[model samples]
Target: MDIEKTFALLNETEPLKISTSREITVAVMGAGSRGNEYPEYGKLFPGTLRVVAVSDILKSRREAMAEKWSIPADRVFGDYREMLEAGRGGKLADILLIALPDDLHYEPAMEAMRQGYDILLEKPMAQSEKECRDLARRQRETGVMVAVGHVLRYSPYFRALKKAIDSGLVGELVNIQHQEPVMYAHMAHSFVRGNWHDGKATTPMIVAKSCHDLDILKWLAGRRCVRVSAEGGIALFRADKAPAGAPERCTDGCPHEKDCPYSAIDIYERKRWFLYVFDLKRDCPAEEILERLRTTDYGRCAYRMDNDQPDHIVVTLLFEGGVTASFSLDAFTPWGGRRTRVMGTEGYIEGDGKTFTLHRFRTGEAREWSYAPPEGGNYRDSGHAGGDLALIRDFLRAVDTRDFSLLSSSIEASVESHVMGFACERSRLSGTKEDV
Candidate 1:
């Protein structure tokens, strides 16, 4: 292996230069966080991509997006069906981005493909394995390009990690250990009191939250997972764990609000984090923010919400070639970055989202690759270490050239992780191994 070349791949921080033959038009189905991300790429590299239409159930999100992209009134619809229907026969745009909730991915994506538009569908493909496979088959039948939201594969950190392993830094990989810590505040906001609280109601926590990790494990291993076993349960956020005098809602003046870690007051009013969910800006006035909290699920006490997502889970995966992996997801944590260790015959690698350390047994040398923000700029400009924008760049090039290989997260490549996730849930429920 060329040691210098491997380090270059790891430490390289140059911008992903993308020059497309022509502008690509996009129609968005959801204007939430993910929706805001993919469309902004068009603004960054104007004429390379354009937002021609948008649709959202939230009127504010719909109106805000229309104003952001200068989308005409006729191009914005309250229901995604109207937008997809309008685009019938591929008249609306060149590509469609389905960034709606977890439950809505498969159906809308199928409809968009049938409408003759290529698509960039959000993660977990669908709620079940059958739906995921159905979407893949649909993409094949339609011959429309389909990009799934497995954004981590494009991130600088994971890209470097994969390159290092491929370069033989970790020779003959044997085992992997990965952990995903879903920060407490995020769990309370999104799972405990938000849309993904019930595993059965939406997608299971294994798929909804950790499918990306599973996908990464498979990608890094260079094989498919053959079997999976798992176990987990909700431990902290149940109603039985509520404080003695806790009210149904934190704004109802629970005595523990001042001290509780999961208090909505602390996360929203005091710290002012996760406000994007409400479509509110960080600079929005505190009183208005408080009012929104008081009326919405965001204000409810985490322990009192009627939610059932597992707070902790551990999975064992066996990939082809006897490669094994151990994965754990826990909700009681300070933040949401993944930690991983990959072990092989010749060396081992350890990573914590921002930095990776490689240890070679042959040379007894240890090296580290650390991420730094772009010169004179902050990483906040893009998510997932700039993976999101990088993916947009590749998707544009793919659409322009009629080359599906440009996509790392295509439906066929991304579905295996969903299979592993469903198998894990099955193992968890049946107390036995599940085949994939």
Candidate 2:
């Protein structure tokens, strides 16, 4: 297959994919947040996909998926190793959702693929450059599909942006700026105090979180990244930033807890957001929540943690068409939405997550596009502004019909973004530019 030609055609209108009348069976590994959510696809597209088995170290998570999917008790394995073992000789499910942590993605996915299962591997699909390539190579060798979770490409807002650009509404792209605001509570919860705190332990926070942004930028550029440079480090969320009265744990009678914006109690117990990571229910008592915080990683003082992720990062990318792009992963923002500006020779575009406006220089008309899913819509719980749901839809259709082009963020396409991210991290650490 001519991979370059395949990607070149991505900008063109996608052709039809074969249809499937029967449901596709799915097995999930690491029944964590993303794992549980992917099964919701079955709810959205009834008879299109179904969850038949799940594996998670946590019994609570495993039982939850089993109960939700009406999966047989025998299918709920406590370890993904066991699930892979069951799938070694024959395919246990049509597709495997490898939503495990950054470190666990490659092994399970490689095993599942060898066992003849197609996959919907989550973003930052592998730990390093080689792993990403290996996954792609394996997909090519096996003749099965692997769709990385670059969900943003499937969003209506972004889809519209890509379409407008491809249509020459924004002609001859030259420069672009994209910003990812990883809000305060989110930065602290996921980066400062949670599983992603230590970059060396899992993967660089850039690769962990901002790879989604990189993928989006690359997709928009419509060309390969040839050069990359970066500069960022832990700025605010450090040991020296902790207040005098702040304790190691927020619940340990810290006097300044009420004032600190990153207070675990305020963010978790009061605001009632990002609670899915914890075992506690939303309706749980404040006291119970506080006690749980005292023991979990969420209770840690954000400023006193061993986190290596930068509170802010800036990356410069040079694409093949001389389309220069700058990406910022900012954590100190009050609100969270990806803001973007695209400059072309004949037109320009600006977007603030929900709404986007296209300006045609040749024609004096400024067109606008806005996406606001209704308040009580079925996708209220769906994340990434319905990108998650749309991604699953495309992946299911691609796998069921055996037409890889039906999906946007295929492994072949995602590998380029990962390469750029790894290069950026290298450039940031070495204080020098790097080639992608």
Candidate 3:
């Protein structure tokens, strides 16, 4: 590809094509939570950043987001490549915010880099280890700015914890214990019977949801995970458990429709309806989604869906420098945040998803703080805990400063997380410890 021509093509599509200065224009590769980069980093953008384009495979999703965000219709593309091609045409955007599905991050990022666009990629960088390495290698070769979606690194709670650790508030870090329940309803709704039903589509559960924990563990230990031992199985929600009279499609006289907690109608159509019904209301009619919920495999009773991923997982990680960490994800918990207990030689830290408590042996006292993010800093507000905005801001800074190292989760860091994820999966399957 002619880099300069591609750049020109993208720039030509911009609303204000005549004048250019230090302002950074961005194109969101996918209209997922990572696409709404405004909420996370808008405070810092001021008049310097602009969201010029957005793309997604679903026309309704793209159009709905574009309309909501006031992006010109011409800037929306069903294909991200076409969007990038336009960017290449005339400098449409300086950075690419990649919030596509887990399996779709690599190609668009590589293409964006080839055309000289910086990248802000969502977590789990790519579908496989090889893809992660390729992206990392390319990033190294091109020296293009790339920031991974590791939002917690920028959060206040974690920042404080890191400071305390460095200051010996927690003394010498020892073993860490944490539990991240996938939540039965959440796993059944999203991972098992929901959109990401196949491991191929989303790797394993660890990578899909708990990569953040893995990243957090790494950050806290300040050491790499050397090995991982895990055990996980599909403890619930299997095809054999379908109700006797349940239809393959819930629309047809399912006996459990009214009372089953795992009912697809209740989960997707009635109780949890707000997500698809409210969020994508502009594109997907609530009734239509409800009707579809009653007719498709996605509508099958949660317990009866063809779910293959584990519903419960236990993982033990051995980090370099003898730091041991244990993590569990149960699929039956109620909707809540997360809980973590970090025990060090000097003190211990306990977090119950909503709040965290740290005890220092030096003082024999504990300090506690709520884990709630600021009111507007949440992504669900803008889309995904405001991670997109923060990600975008970081990418823009890297672009303007020509500093690829500015990545909060550099490609190398992201790859290491993926490697740990793979190790966890291997241990889950083989019932043995796997080296990271």
Models ranked on TM-score: 1, 2, 3
Per-residue lDDT of model 2, residues 73-103, tens digit only:
8788988999998887687799999999888
Worst ten in a row by lDDT for model 2: 10-19
- Full-model lDDT for every candidate: 0.87, 0.84, 0.70
Per-residue lDDT of model 1, residues 41-112, tens digit only:
777767888888999999999998899889999999998889877877455999899999998888888888
User: Which stretch of 10 consecutive residues in model 1 shows the poorest summed lDDT?
Assistant: 372-381
If scored against the real structure, what TM-score would every candidate get?
0.96, 0.93, 0.85
- Model 3 lDDT tens row, 1-436: 2323322232121111112247777777777654654423543434567666889887777886777657897898998778877866664677778888887888888877777777778877888888989999998888777888887665445554555555555668888887887666677778877657677777788888888888888887889999999888887677676668777766667887787776666766666543552244534555877666765566766766666778888899999989899988888888645677888887787876434676767667666654444433333233233333444555566677777665677878888988898889888888887988
Cα lDDT for residue 335, candidate 1: 81
Please report, as a residue range, the 10-residue window in candidate 3 with the lowest summed lDDT.
10-19
Highest-scoring model, TM-score:
1
Ranking by lDDT: 1, 2, 3
TM-score of model number 3: 0.85
